[model samples]
Target: MSGHGFHVHGPHDHELEHAQAGEHGGEHGEHSGMINQIALFTAIIATIGAIFGYMGGATQANAGLYKNNAAIRKTEASNQWNFFQAKSTKQSLAELARDLAPEDKKSGYQAKIDRYEKEKNDIKVVADKMELDAMHWEKQSDEQMHQHHRWAQSTTVLQICIALAAISLLTKKKWLEYAMFAAGGVGIIVGVLAALHI
Candidate 1:
């Protein structure tokens, strides 16, 4: 017995497991009004799942929108940086021209260089702002993604609760039914927390 995490099973064992599950699904009919109550509770859980599923979809869409906005801002920032580079090139050329020109023309070249410098600074400020905006949008996308994940978790729990309730109805075991209710309550709490984005 290597006794690792994995185990080997025979084909007969697999069939037995399925046969047992099928038997379980067909069993419970002795309890009074128990199955009906479980069916009602299952309906309620399904409704909650539907609502949270919609919320998850919305949050996912919002996250995508924010991500797209971030990409657009980043593209705009790249364009601004390209403009800044062009201005820098022009300023370098103007400085070279001033160096080669006569003393009388030096002032004109100096003025061009000064204007280019100011333009570069302006472009830099705009590009910096665009970068900041992109980062902000990315942060917003991350937040929405977190909310979406929470909603997904809640929805999954609700699904589990519904499945448990169905199983309880089939088995007609009072203890199992109570367990199903407990699971449903936990699912409700999780759903509410997801709605709160916590």
Candidate 2:
């Protein structure tokens, strides 16, 4: 009575069958109705749980991607800073050469120093922009990770609700069913928070 990971009769199905057999007409009908209600609730919760699981996975992937992007931007910024340092070193050498050079050669060294200064400034601007971009990407990654956690929380709560539903169905406990519904409501509220990116 099983297909695709689902069983037509669950673990306590034998007990249920025995109880129904011994029950009179109205009692049997009531038991049947309760089973149907739980079945519907379980199905809905399972579906919601699946959706939440997928969202969690997607958000996790996005977080990873954003983190990688941040790393790349940081690397680019480091490279630009290295370029700037190289230019600074060159400019320092040119300044030293200008001080030691003859009067005619000093102008050439001074021109080289000026060119190096301009290039370093440009590199500094690019490096600073890249650093800012890296920070932005890191922030985005953090937000995505937070959302992923929210989705995971929602999914876990829904799983607990589903487990409660199964237990209620097996034990035929009205209180258990009520608890299952309460858990389901909590799960849905968490899911709403996730959707709103709270």
Candidate 3:
């Protein structure tokens, strides 16, 4: 219509064009928001999985250390028991000598019995303390194992969340996305508990 020789649409046409543009823009925004959220969720899942994996490894190491310490304590306790048995044999022989010896030798044997009794008591105290130490190490090992179990559970859940996230991105299902997020939330909570050694 103008000197440029190009036709311009009427007001009605302009209104229809604007409406279609707005609809398309809205759809694009919605889709982009979903993609952004999925990306963020995937990153969070990967991070949680990594942290829990490290924690699991640390717990395993602690358990092994405790087991080694327990073994050491047990060895020491066994050695003490062997020494205690030797003392017992010496005590029996001393008693037998005291009962059969002359009166002059009897007093010497009595002194030996007294000395042996004191040594046995000392050994008993040391042996009991060593056994208690071994039990403490065993208990610590159990606690580490329990914490490791929690970390393992959290790691599994995080892996599931990651898998679900992958599936969601491919299928673009909002339900699947939400489910992935839910699983990730659970995994995070479990990881926190494990960190707290609960």
lDDT of each: 0.88, 0.93, 0.91
- 21-126: candidate 3 lDDT, tens digit per residue: 6567765557667878888989978987998999998998999999899999999999998999899899999999999999989999999999999999999999
Error of 3 at 1 (Å): 22
Minimum summed lDDT over a 10-residue window in model 3 is located at 22-31
Give per-residue lDDT, candidate 3, residue 182: 96
Q: lDDT at 28 for candidate 2?
A: 67
**For candidate 2, which ten residues in a row score worst on lDDT?**
18-27
- TM-score head-to-head 1 vs 3, winner: 3
- The TM-score measured for candidate 2 stands at 0.86
Model 2 CA deviation exceeding 4 Å by range: 1-25
lDDT of 2 by residue, 1-198 (tens): 988998787659977776677465566678788898989999999999999999999999999999999999999999999999999999999999999999999999999999999999999999999999999999999999999999999999999999998899889999999999999999989989999999
Residue 25, model 3, lDDT: 78
Per-residue lDDT over 17-116 for candidate 1, one digit per residue giving the tens place of the 0 to 100 score: 7666655663332343576688888998899889989999999999999999999999999999999999999999999999999999999999999999
Q: Could you give the C-alpha RMSD of every candidate to the true structure, in order shown? A: 13.7, 9.2, 5.5
Q: Which stretches of candidate 3 lie over 4 Å from their true place?
A: 1-24
Q: Going through the candidates in order, what is the number of backbone clashes in each?
A: 0, 0, 0
Give me candidate 3's TM-score against the actual structure.
0.86
